[model samples]
Target: MAVPVVTGRHARLVRVTHALTTLCFLALVITGAEIIISHPRFYWGEVGNVNTPSLFDIPIPASRPWVNTGYGFVMPDQNGWSRSLHFQMAWLLVFTAFIYGTWGLRTGHFQRIASYYNTAQRRTYLLVIFALMPFMIWTGLAMSPAIVGTFPFLVTLLGGHQSARTLHFFTTLALLLFIAGHVVMVIRTGFRSNVRAITVGGDTQA
Candidate 1:
């Protein structure tokens, strides 16, 4: 007799990581948007600043008056605290991912996902884990003053600090969209049942 396979459930460890990722990502997005308000201009190449010719700029007023937002007023500057929170949350997210990725590989959890997810879900997971995250980390570090100071090549590889910042903005947008779509998926698939299945590990009701 063949062994039976159980789907519609998640391991305890998986659920824990999922929850942590959600919290960390939420903080990151909030802080990221707050940081963006300080300066909305974007540029390319080895250098860019308030005086440099911007490739483009958001029409809204900047939180910092030093930034030429073409508006007379400035928004309240939240850049200081937001940047601190963003940096801290980003590391938490990275650590959680590292643990999950290592465990998934060691236990063949990635391969086992085929039993639970359809092609689209698998593709989304793979793309997020393998591509978007690494790219985001790279670009994020590229924008950091200390990181770039120590590893100048990091920024050089991405072209410049401003380039990294631009890419990071777009990447954040992509992550937000992914989260939105994921919520829609959960709702469509049966919100309460799916939530229970993931949290408590059991087959969900249709």
Candidate 2:
């Protein structure tokens, strides 16, 4: 089979969206890791606090002087900084995603891909772009207290804020795995040609 090459306005838009998504996702993941380390536990339902029985716990070492037990190892609680960056990047992701989705649909980008690519590849792309991404966005919003307060039904639909948080974490893991697999596929198909088509926006004979 001939390797697929992306070009023209569609290629340009895809490249831009891919870059923005990568940067924003990386920021979110780093910030999310820092935030999770502080609590290091997962729960469910509307209410979960320090006293609540955790569904699962990660053994993150305590850092605060009062909580320290001679062991120096600790995960820094950077929620204040991380949370701010996380939300900012999240908004950026949402905006870029909207642009990409709208343009792709209007330009028949999805149709072209579906026609050109094999069934497996087409299905994977559709699943990632349509199904998984929307679910991730929904779960992310559901976890936000402010968002949930404004639209209480969001959290209720997800079972609860904690449930949304749990789903978000797992969804993130799945996305990471998808990214890894995508990279491998690109390498196997035609790395140099793929990179040039995406970066330079021109016809590439793969």
Candidate 3:
């Protein structure tokens, strides 16, 4: 059987989506890391304060470490900016993902991509797109006070805000792992050819 080539339209759409997603995801990851590092602890329940015992401590710089008189390392509080940019990028991700998903489904783009890959790869892609992404989004919203106020059930469904926060952290780790694997696979398959195909709708041989 002959290998199928990605159509021009599909390639263009994939390229655009990939660029948008990469930009948004990178911003989110950097900001998210800063936000998490500031706190450096995970807790469970709707209420978690510094005084309260944490479920797990990450051993990173605690927020407001400069407050301590003898603290060596000094890091300014970036939570305000990080939190703002995180939400902004998150919304961008949501919008781009929605468009990519809708277009892929309507035009059978996913089917074509799946047909090009092995069963394991196809399954992994499906799981990431359908399961992990949605769960991550849900957990993120559950951690938001504004979102929780509008939809109390979100936090309830996740057990608590802190639980949601913990889950979001783990989900982020999972996504990083997925991205690493994806990049490795792309390089192994044929980096230049694949890049050309997606970037400029160039033809590729199987």
TM-score between candidate 2 and the true structure: 0.84
- Backbone clashes in each candidate structure, one number apiece? 0, 0, 0
Name the regions of candidate 1 deviating beyond 4 angstroms.
1-5
Top-down TM-score ranking:
1, 3, 2
lDDT per model vs. reference: 0.83, 0.79, 0.81
Output the worst ten-in-a-row residue range by lDDT, candidate 3.
Answer: 1-10
lDDT score, residue 186, model 2?
74
Which candidate should be chosen as best, given TM-score against the real structure? Answer: 1
Minimum summed lDDT over a 10-residue window in model 1 is located at: 1-10
Model 2 pairs in collision: none
Pairs of residues clashing in candidate 3: none
Off by over 4 Å in 2: 1-10, 62-72, 203-206
Best by lDDT: 1
